[model samples]
Target: MNTLSSIDYIIFVLYFVLVASYGYYVFKKKKAQEHDSKAFFLAEGSLTWWAIGASLIASNISAEQFIGMSGEGFFVGTAVAAYEWIAAIALIIIAVWFMPVYLKNRIFTMPQFLKTRYNDSVALIMAIFWLFLYILVNLTSILYLGATAITGLVGDATAGTPEFQNILHLIMIGLAVFALIITLGGMKVIGYTDVIQVAVLIIGGLATTYLALTIVGDKLGVGNSAIAGFKALMNDSPEHFKMILPRPAATTGTINTPLNLDIQKWVVLPGIAMYFAGQWIVNLNYWGCNQYITQRALGADLKTARTGLIFAGMLKLMMPVIVMLPGIAAFVLHKHNALPGFSGSKDGAYSAILSFLPSGLKGLSIAALTAAIVASLAGKLNSISTIFTLDIFSKYIAKEKADEKKLVITGRYTVLVASILAILFTWNDLLGIGSEGGFTFIQKYTGFISPGVFAMFLLGMFWKRTTGTAAIVGVVLGFVLAIFFNNYAVGIFGKETWLYTAYTYETLGKDGLAHATTEIPFLINMGWSFVITVATMIGISLAGPKINPKAFMTDKALLKLDNRTIAMIVITLILLSALYVKFW
Candidate 1:
């Protein structure tokens, strides 16, 4: 049954009512602070540590993770979990080190940090850059991917048909409206309501994962057991269980011939090489530096923020089980010829597995996915509103310091406009997201800026000697270097340079014809770009004052970690270590 049953609708309706009523309750409670810009945008001191933690995971795991990461799980297996697991370590670094810098400096936004540490030019450039990236890349992808995934669950509308497109548009609009309802209420509503969202998504996601595994077990002639199903998956798809993919050997095959799939997987993950390359940059930049992510903790005290981040890190440990396992299960089922009529698109793996779900449980899984998508949509819209209203509008458009009420109103308006723009771009798939694959599309585009942004933040924080001129040059150079390394480096440096090897693979283009694409793995590209950018910035800064006059000063007291923080850090490390030991 591809369509929802009456029971499914009832459960979904109850979920909708529960989230709406709770959001209303939160909005009413925080009504007094509604006019305050900081209160509206960041929730100020209102969000509890758990709320912050929940909201962090809620915002971070969207359709991108559910649909995209699971799809990757189907294609490449456990290696994709590196994004989530490494994020645990990244959150630890941010909590202990980066949080001290930001909280001690009273930094509320990424642009504000740049302005305070570097200069107005660097901040303004990045503010605009972030706005475009969020709206065009992040927001649109979330909306498109989320809507497409939900539409699959809704009914069997044939892909590429008029009805399918119509259903997709309706879901996109519905998601935008749903996010708007929560976002307009401000961050307090988003943060508190996210607790409910996280609960729903977890229960629902786990149910889906369990059912998927049981289906695999039953298909394998084992009892209908999740444990048995999981064992079957590992036994059947042993290649998918590896933490590090083996590097592809040089092989001769044409686009017409069957090329090695390892080359294709390497193009996405890049094996152990990724650990040394863009993997750290990707996680660090996303967990520590991105506005959509970091905003949840920015308003809290040092201890509260750090604790919340660590708590979120612990939650990150189990995320792959909820998000990635089903795709691996689906791969096992597909391998055993259990998934009839499967279209073979890796992105479809999660939804395909969902079809195995029982009625009420199916509703729960849909709600879970809806929770992830809505939470992320609300979070991204809020961040977009925060940047445009506070960083751009308040700083530039306002002749004088805008009143709190005016700024708050500006934020609401920004959210509305940004949501509209996202829907519009996603409507036609203007960015060719479907062709590139959602997870790869986001990672590749975002990678272009990560190297530069991470370098700027890393050096700006630790190296007081990093000059404003160097910061400005570094951002631009990093982006240019990233583009060069991704597209032109293999051409210019030759395919087998000492620096890196470009892998050739044939993938279907938009016209449905296989095209030979050769490129250096993007993560490797990012690592080289970051190295060159940092070296250039260091060289440029060396010509200036030893200590930049505007550099942020840090104190030892500000960096102190409490016992709870240390304990959580230890627990996180232990869990992460065990996971790698099992999977590696």
Candidate 2:
């Protein structure tokens, strides 16, 4: 069942050729302006509203969403959809408010924003942090998880087998090379080709989802119908359909004998607490502040940027259906003992669901997965290259008016170097992405920096009294508090506190024995960290000036919303409200 038919190979090959050919067409059309840094990195003004919108979604959805989020779906159910759902609202805010500021200020990169608002020191420090985070956490996980997912479809593979590991390496390298081809063509190529990539991603993903639901229905003795399969899932695994997880109950059992699986679930997603805490930070910082995402709209005029962002938000509404529902279906089937030889790893849920796909359709699904992985890889590599070439190299190494050709060449080299490093790190699973669950692993590590980065950006933009010193200190303090809350707070202050309660859960250790670990939920940690960091920053800034000398001039005109923008915003809100009302 894992093996692909000849028709499947033909479908996949055709897809590869179509994308490559289109990417080449885009590259050649823009070849004359490719040397311009803005054109190469941001695609400048070439991208239309639709291209920008599709590119935004393409860059954002990768192996992490397809595999990691689906894995989360298998384990935690609809609650995991919060990440995608909240992102819709976040994009709205960015379109209306954040996009105006960015476009008016002509900010091209995140570090550049820091340098303009605060000081050179703050900018330089963050540039380094972002570089490491992108390569180590974001890039590595995408490669490792994507390779793992595709390898599952290629053969009857078992985890930890020699054959499986060998296939994984080949897929990782192949993915890296494919991404490099797109990335070297620069941002125009990335943006335009992403239109096709997003199309394949959605179509193939929906095809897989439909089949998964039908399989579920057929397995439950109903006819092969997606609606029937969905009903069967809801009927069979009622607990998985909840939007919020309950708080962990007090545990009295030993580590191995009596497992608190509910507590483990709560640890990953801590109910209303997360809604009040890291949820906003995660969405806002990602959609508004991150270079990899915001770069899509940075090159456009104000109206175009706003429209593109709203378009992306609309697309986000359907993402959970494409990415998360299959895992839930897999859970229903696995619970019924319908999936033979399944390993029961949460990350394997997507692959197990793919077994239901017909021969030609199997190739289409793999193409979808490959599209997600390659688009994200190319996007991340471009961002890494942008930061290094523009933020670091332009300022430090060149220290003069650099030539456009040299800058473009430097950016390409950075992409190659970053891809190699990511592949090397992911080769051995050195980051333990598999153990932590891919979705949770990304959120946890990224949480360490989000509190600080979001705090800095928020205070810098709105609060003119916020000084450079406050910005620097806030960044450090946010990180420190996040670490304290995550690692040491429970041990120092006992499990129960007025602020938050730490929960104890047993997880299987490397020795194949359960071990009890106690910790405050990470989202709660991020929330408290943000609150305290903002307070400290405010106090420090109060001593500076009522309005800092470098404060950006603003006018009512900048925040004004057009009729079209307003219409889109209203539609997005209506859809978003209905979703939460039903799920909540």
Candidate 3:
């Protein structure tokens, strides 16, 4: 039966009450000064390693990871976990390479750092882009997908009844309101609440994993032991265990992937490209330059931040087992028709598996999803506010000594307005925006901006010759190129997007849908986009104006890395390499 029991309802109630109560208590305890942006936005830079560590995971481990990445596991298999594993390496890199420079500059927002490193125009452009990107892509997608998960677990979205519709809206609004409330307390509240949220996330997520494997074993008409069932799974559907995917030969025009999911859309399977080059661009853009993520590290001292990042890296190593295995279990169950409630969908795997949870644990599963959604929502809203307050409003509109009280008030107002806009976007999506492909569709669209952002940040940080004009040109050029690759590549390449690249696909007709199967993998496309942007930036920098590179400092002492940081970096690189080899 796809429903919650009375005890399940009780757990749900307690989950929200305790979470809200703890958040409010932290807010009341702090009573941060409204006149201080640092106090409001960063918890006065007084957070410890534990809080920073917890908050980093809480912020990063949102609907995107739980709902989206798990959806990917079902859609493309275990290779989807490259996003999580690659992030482990990226976190270590950020701790040692990025944080030292960021902390030295006392940077509040990424755009603020750009303002210092580049120009006001560059910073302002980046700021406005981020604000809308959060609203347009991140906010809407998280709310929609999280609500979709709630609907799958609690009710039916396609029931064609007013009661079902009301249930769905109520859940979506409830999640949004909870995130808004937590964000009202500022970073201190978010940081402390994350510690508890992450604990629930881990316990509930692990419980889901254990139960899923048990259900799979029973479905196979074997025993109900997770370990035994896992062995049975290897015996039955060994394809699910493959971490690397093969592409078709250059002469062959079509790839034959497992489950025969679109060969082109499933990008993580493109073997060496994904492991060596493509993943680095995507991970660095997300873990290093993404403001909401790096903001947590900014809240602590460098030592604490490094320790916390290492802790986060270690935790990430567990996610493939926790967050993804259940999805793979769902796929195996649905493919074999082993579960009565099974439905084949990109997002259906997680929800279909929820039907197997016994009463109270079902509540924990939903609580885990709720925790994921709200943690990310709160983190995003705060970043939106921070960027708007420091980079846009204060830098331009407000006077030099504009009242800090007013600035903080403006920050709160930004959060409120942004929360409302996000809700509206979600409502629009429910009516229909990306109702079909779910998480994967949203990710493909992000390639338009992510690579460019990565290119700008990577080069600007390392190459002092990158002038403001060149930065703008290169970034704008990147956008145009992404548009061509995603939308107009067919026209440019004459109905074959892979004439230049080695990938291959056949556009399939799907119930009159307008989208075409992408021949070029999204990550590979992003890697190419980054290369072109870097080339463009370098061409302009060298031809027009010559300047010394940032890494070309006369001080040889600056080249030295801390012994501890050096050790962490080495460990991170070695682990990442070993993972690829093992998976391959």
Candidate 4:
């Protein structure tokens, strides 16, 4: 009953060789630049559109999405695909509106851009926050989630069990070490190696999708046809295909408050807010301004960056097929049928589908999943190094007195320090994190800052009068809003409510009038949080001492994008609009 065979192991080994050797060669090529900080950190400004595009996708789509999104699909339906949908539009927006300014500024980290555009204080605080968030939330969560996925897919570590919990720590260590080894080679190696990583992920993901369909088809007595299987799945779980969710409600009584009511509701999924608003905050911040993912698009010129971003957008459009479809497919196969043998759990759907990969392809498919984890880990580690070296070490610790070689060396050591910290955090998290589910867990924490980050970046670029002082306040406001919404909603609002957490109804006192409710879905939480962040930023910006506009764009020339860029955005918009309409 082994999922992988000897042949599968051979394929996995060969893939490992191909990726490791190629990464090694790239690292060796950059050996001469190890002493040159810019060259080492930014690939000597030489990445092409294809490399940038591939690295963007490779770094962005990890086990979190691969495993978590599908898990959500199993539990909540295709509504989880909204993450990818939001990202597609966000990518297009970034390419057309944001990349030009970033290329002109030539910033290394997101905090650096903030520093130059705002002030040293703004940048410094953000640098420290970025490092903290990267290590604590981004890296640790990825490690835990990625390790959890590997344990489930590759072995018999059933989730939520004590045995699996122990294995999670070991897997975290393994994935952390593996990422550190790759990241030590620096950005050049990763920028190129990601091409192969993305290719493997897509090929393997497609293979799994095809195989799942065929297996379902045969299981349904359709003669092992993928088309027949897909149709059968459609027939079996049509409800799982819904993209637009309705208002979330549970029957009778708000949390902690008691009154007999006719109806009670909690939003399992926040419907309209997810599409028009909530998901956008996550996407815009992630695609437009995230340090590591955007770092992949850096180094290249504006044209290449634009092309690459658009290309990444196209890839984003396709991700639902590779990542989300499998979850939906798994739902169809497992929901009504017992064949896939997965317990109806949120996180196990993707791992359960791994049971159908047959013999030879299991290695390739597992390699793909592994690629998602390792590539994403390497990218985050590299970003952490870049931020630490350029933002923290050079700026505060060394005061820019350090030379190229010293900075590069600091970058290398930083990879070790950050990984150890992330590993430690993952170990701690293994004891018990709440069961918000993986996808929800990631977004819930992310909502803490994504909205504020997006608002600052967006306004900083377009609004001429936004002050650095205002920017600082805006960022602080975002964290405050998220803290209130996520942890204090029930306390502050007098009862649990999803969106409009601070909302009030026409009542004398804030008691349980309508009904009881559940915790808000994370996406809707993000959406409402974004609104507060935006409002705070605008209010603060209009209130007082605005920084000089020239700081953001003193001498940079206006960008003239080529037709390819225009076409890319247009097509992205068309597809994005089409989806909401079709699914709405």
Candidate 5:
């Protein structure tokens, strides 16, 4: 505790007070209009492009990304930034092809689209799965990680108490604050606060980056020293920094040597292959279909919506610079011995960030980190409440044609309840119970629901033959496959195979098998989830009865077009090419 200067404490307290005050202001300004399902979940379709764009960025980029993904970039290199670049393409596609349908239908929730396109049963199932996953996986795990990081950064102030007890207390406090904000106002509050959050996140990220560069530059004593140092770090440890590291075979007890021919191959191409082939299918279902996220765009007019989507896409282009570059810089500046507990071989970019913080800057940096975490918490809290209130409670328990005011009140209550559950779940420390590094639990749990939910909505949208029965089967199968692949197949089966053993031995030596493992098993599980879901849906649709195509598509909906779609596609392709050149 003595190591933490008073400056750090003051900065933290100031940040907390400012955020709390802002939340209160947002709550106070919320319109008192009838808060029906539409207003509660979708902000009564009143957002403009700027608010929509900022909210999207704030919601998407959070502590999980800054700490976890940046840690990945530090360990693996810029190749990890592929997720952002790839998403640029996905977002464009959604803007051009997907948004029109959603907007035209005036759908509030993605599940509602399912109900209309498939059947009520499909919608209900999806709603249940999404709600459960939100509480158990997304909301809880993120809160845990954010809370843990804050505790670590703040040190001892919240320590000495029982570990789990302190974490639970912190999470509950955070969640309660978040719930209060959302309850007072719905998407309007979220959007307004997001603009502020996004601004803070960018400024803070850039400040960190600039400080790191200056420190590195001064150490090496050259203008190009920072770049040289970065290159040296990568060059000196080829295996660690290389975009494509070796992997064990699935069956042969051999190395998959040929797969590493091209650097792009190692980066995210295989994952991208799964993505376009499968992952995008799910992401579209997320951005285009998911209510909580999409509600921002849905609030905009058509042109504003299109602009918002494009603006978000453009902002994503800067993500690697903010998240990945800092990690790389941290690794370069600090070297292997930079931070305690991360000295053996793997780069400790995240640890380095903490280690390298100077006195005054430390407080500001911690404040920024706190802001990122709180922003994520706020978005998830609002969205989870939105989905629960709109899709589940309104449909099943409360059938009244509630006015907007009543709906807003219900939304507030829902956020409170969800926040409580999330706080309780966070207290359990399920996030840290696993063997994988920090935040692995989040990725694993998300895999279970994300793939399946994605599958259900995608098929519901495109395939007229997809019946309620087929949807249920696809959703269930997707979930089962995602779990099996994520847990049993990758964790157990993948490790024991002769191929894995051989590859591990060859690439990493006799002990290679011990070190050579993926954190996410992304390639295997993601691929399996998609293939199984698509096959089951198609096979079942063919074997069983066919559904009316008219229900899924209409003349006006099918033929609609806007120039924004073309622009998005072009921009995405150009950006993808640029990423390949820079990282590969």
Candidate 6:
């Protein structure tokens, strides 16, 4: 590992101090108030659209999306931008249809909605599932990745050792500290800090993107070299860069072409399909329905809440340019080589960032990376604490009529506990066990829970006949399907044989093809999971008796036509399609 220059160390120190000071300032402000748990957890129902909007973006675009999604874009192409585009549409839907329901009912959490729409048992089940999912899937894994990335950038001088063990410890500690600060003031604090953090994150992300383009352009010997390199890389590795790469045939060592020429065929396609189908559902449930996230919105008046969602959606559209483009640039700049002083040859986007960065800019870039990761961790920690306090503690564990001050205290303690647990879990080194693969284990696990959650929420919202029993059943079935599709049927059987064959045929003709096949497990998992989940939900709904539709219909929650929501959704979709056609 390289030594950190004095400047880098100074920058790091300054960042830490600034973040901590912000936390302290928020704490002081909240402490002066006649505190109640509701105020702490819900920001005293006071937040503007801008604060909520920034916080929402900051919370959602964590290390996972920055590192993992960007890496995928580097290895593949712009096709991975689906996450952002899909989310844009999803947010609009939430603003139009879902926001009214949440605001009208004055619900505090996503599960709280389930409780009202379904029953307490159903709500409890969803709450428990979400809590576990947030801890295991979102918080822990993000901390692990963020820490790993930051430690890598800081090198051995600050981290003490270049070994994975040392790195993981540093990450967990950093995440825990940030979590503590976020918990100090609850949603209001999170909102205020998020405004600052989001600024840091964007400036940092854009800085890296600019530095990357500059360095890569210099190396390739052309002003437009970054763009040229991208085109060249695409030409050389057409298969890797293509959005519609072919899938492996069912029989070993065969290649199967889809009947539809226009359909995308990359390994990411299935996941992308699932994302398009499921992500909007989850996003609406999140931005519009989920309380910890939406508490910021609910705190706002209806106008501000609407404005925030719209503003956040606009921000979401810009993410691909910042996060995805750099990854693509990385692959173009550092093909088939280790970054300077690294032990092994680097692969994909992360390697690109390391190799292409210059000396002074490297420090600033690293700080930006750290900021993005911290922003993500802080947002999740705050949200998780909010859910625990409102959905579980206030309802089940402690029914005491606590004032805002006492409630804030309780919330701070919960944040501390949640942060500790997240750090501990992240420190366990699950990613190390699966480090051999190009993709991280965290991404694989995310594929399982996210898709399932998305499916359940979509069915529940749109289908009035959908029962609590059906929703619960859908969750179970969706989860099982995710596992099977990700692990067994698609993962083990899909890509290995054909990939080996293609490589072998290129090297030594048909004779070597038999042994060269490699599996594309993610594609298979995603494809089957989608098929099965949709099938199961539809079949069950049909087989089961229909509940009265009137029970699910709440006129107050539905937007009036004057709102322009329907027109916005249509126009957004059309514009996105045009962009996809023009760019990808």
Give the Å shift of residue 434 in candidate 2. Answer: 1.0
Tens digits of per-residue lDDT for model 2, 77-173: 9999999989989999888878877888899999999999999999999999999999999999999999999998895667788888988899899
Clashes of 3: 0
Give residue 576's error in model 6 in angstroms. 3.1
Candidate 1 vs candidate 4: the TM-score winner is 1
Tell me each candidate's TM-score.
Answer: 0.98, 0.98, 0.92, 0.90, 0.83, 0.82
Give lDDT for model 1.
0.91
Instruction: Report the error of model 1 at residue 382, Å.
Output: 0.6
TM-score for candidate 4, residues paired by index: 0.90
For residues 25-84, write the lDDT of model 4, one tens digit per residue.
888877777688887677857789999999999998887878877777666566667778
lDDT of 1 by residue, 196-279 (tens): 999999999988998988899899988789898888888888999999998876553345443557788888899899999899
> What Cα-based lDDT does every candidate model obtain?
0.91, 0.91, 0.76, 0.75, 0.63, 0.62
| Candidate with more favorable, higher lDDT: 2 or 5 | 2
User: Per-residue alpha-carbon lDDT of model 5 for 1-584, expressed as tens digits?
Assistant: 42458887787777667766775686566545445556556776677787898888888786567776666666566656656776677677777667777777777676778887777788888878778877777776666656655555554543336764565466547645754564456677777777777887787777676666665555555454456655554564454343334542333222544432222223222333444443464456557766656878876667778778878888888887777777766665546444454442222355356646677677776666666666666677777777776777767877676655666677778777877787776675655522343434555556666666777666666677776777788888888877675456645664545321211222344455623434224444655686678778888788755665535564454445567656665776887787677545
- Candidate 6: TM-score? 0.82
Error of 5 at 153 (Å): 1.9
Question: How many residue pairs clash in model 2?
Answer: 0
lDDT of 3: 0.76
- Report the Cα lDDT for residue 547, model 4: 53
Question: Measured by TM-score, how close is model 3 to the native structure?
Answer: 0.92
State the lDDT of candidate 3 residue by residue for 264-312, as single tens digits: 4344456666666468887788888888888888877778788788778
